[model samples]
Target: MYRLLLQNALRPSLQKRRMKDIWVWNGMRMTEVDRIMLGLRQRIKQLDENVVILEKEDDRNLYGAISLRIIELELAEILALLDTLNRTTSNYHHLIIETTAQLQDMMDTMVALVKFDKMQVIKKEHENQQIKKDLEKCKNEQKATLPPPTLSPGHCGLGQMVNVSGPKTYSLTAYGTSYSFGAWGRDVNPAPGNDKYWLVVLSSSNVYGHYVRQYSTLSTLLLGLGPTDTYISSSNPTTNTIQGPNMVMYGNALYYNCYYTLSICRFNMTTRTVSTVALPKDAGYNSKFPFGILGKSYDYTDIDFATDESSLYVIYATTGNFGNVVITKVETSTTPVLGETWYTSLYKATATNTFMVCGVLYATRYIDKETEQIFYSFDTKTNEERYDLKIHIRKMQPNIEYLNYDPRDHLLYVYSDAYIVTYEVMFQ
Candidate 1:
């Protein structure tokens, strides 16, 4: 009887020791799996870095003519290696899952052993009640310390307001002869305050004739211009000489970059007069890259003009200081002239496109076709930069050659290779 009583007294201690041993064994296995995963991740990152270097080489040099064959072979090898690593990682993951299930089963069996003790169960219930009271007290403290929320126009309720309604697809056809303008048309602008949604199309060569076509916003129909409509001028002094992949229409004036000159051209719609304004002395001009010779104008100079709800602004990087951006407001009451000027240290080359929205300067960079474009906004009001906002485009093209934001309708116009897509910008 004494031996039996002693065995019963030591039974709980033996069970605890077995549970501890199982936990230690499971922990060791989990740690090994984690180390393997970490190594695999590091290898993948190295491969990705190599791929980026290869892509840079392809873009900078003529990869098609010289290294195309070699690049193909290298890419194939890398892909195969990645596949092997992925399979190995998957097998390890499965092992981890199985081990985790075994650990859970051990824990459940240990919990079942405790079911025999009624006093232990009552103690656990009391402890759980105390934990609940502690959690409720923490929640109350957090609520009391939280700051009051600020409100803005067009915003209501505790949730964020997002405007996701806009055209998903856009149509782009040859405006004039195919030879007159390259694959993509030159510049496209919407007529200000026009209810009919009149779009102005310019040929690649500014010297060529301007075409005014109307599109029904309701029907998405592209109406060709009639022979009698003469809204687009056939002749202008700055024709062929206008330098731009950028243009903004404000009121009755169309402001454009003047080619071969450090100036911006202003064309009055009602008066039909052209004027030019010289940029700041240090404003950079022309592409600094070899590809700029291929007619990618924005590559050389990085000078751009954008308009917000209340004003027009010119943003450009200074020579020798490519990373510094200078933004100058344009006073268009008379001739186009620079207004309040501000400078930011953001690099201009990082952006594929830049535009102003409600006085804030936003720069966008391509983040692949599947993902949304990345954006960084510089607030002109507070001189602060923000990158926390989430903006998603349903579909993105490989290259967004041009971008324009229309504040009136909160629409973002994108000019990809041969397509002009517009997305509605929902502010949160």
Candidate 2:
């Protein structure tokens, strides 16, 4: 019992020594941690500085590249705009020259009509005073008559699509339902003695095409003869090539939808030159709002080119117009430019095809494999629409891939399932 009491008494001192040792150990441990944290803080500061430098350097490089790209794009746009202006001015100069010639011809025609043929075929004035009087009388008559046209414009033949008959399948294509989509027509306003019939066949994908085959005559196209000229651009889906199957030849220019662009490509076969005209800002392209019904759609055919009595029209839908069909008149004297825009109430996706007759826009829909019905019409002259036209188009195939009216022949040229067909349009 005495030994146990002595051990307990020494235990308090032993416990005090252990507590002191623990306190010293903890102080050493804390000091080491402080030293480690100091090293880590310096390393972290260095890393932060390096990261900031990298970020700033990267920003500088990107900013320089971005600014340069923006400048390049701006310069390119300015160059294109200046080029267009130059072209338009050159066209105006040509117009002035033509106008002067027309004016001289018109004056000569007036002189002939008024019996003032410059002393030829008319009685010569006997007295000098009478000659002056006769000249004065001619001048007075000229002032009294209506002035001649500054430009000798062609007569406008405007009418509605009254009735359509017979799907006479033209023997043109050798594709034979394998291609199944294309566009074919004559020039709406052919220069004298232009018997060229153009055919554009899409690739097997039916999304884009680049080849344009021109037959020398209708017989050549019917006989499936080799083309007089075949223009093949840089492969399929290239920009400025025939993108969609909806196209038309008018005034020696091939107007069609351009690939990778919401615009019209006017390719002049005579000059081998190309021009582009931009569509509306909200115009739909890239298979958006194409001609279709509830479940089926014609792929990559959002743009349709049509011709009337004296004008070329572009049919398209716009997001701003709620996917409704909009027709814009295109002027093709030199570079194609937008003339006038007409909006229709018909939905673009609801129609299977569309065409222009005289000054009216007609929309068609699939009724069956053998017949498609014209269910709507929009008169550009009157800015009116009619849905009761109900003109049925006879078809040799199920789908009409492309349909356009040739004002030159008064025929509807249809490219349906690899075959070309034509129908004569009856007027109202």
Best by lDDT: 2
The TM-score obtained by model 1 is 0.52
Candidate 1, position 31, lDDT? 57
Model 2 lowest lDDT segment of ten: 145-154
TM-scores, one per candidate: 0.52, 0.62
| CA shift of 320, model 2, Å | 1.2
Over the stretch 126-171, how does candidate 2's per-residue lDDT look in tens digits? Answer: 5666889968964654343223212112235433334675655555
lDDT tens digits by residue: candidate 1, 226-274: 3122243454423524444556666656666665567777766556677
Error of 2 at 392 (Å): 0.7
Candidate 1's C-alpha runs over 4 A off are 1-169, 174-202, 205-240, 288-301, 387-390
State in Å the error of residue 222, model 2.
Answer: 1.2
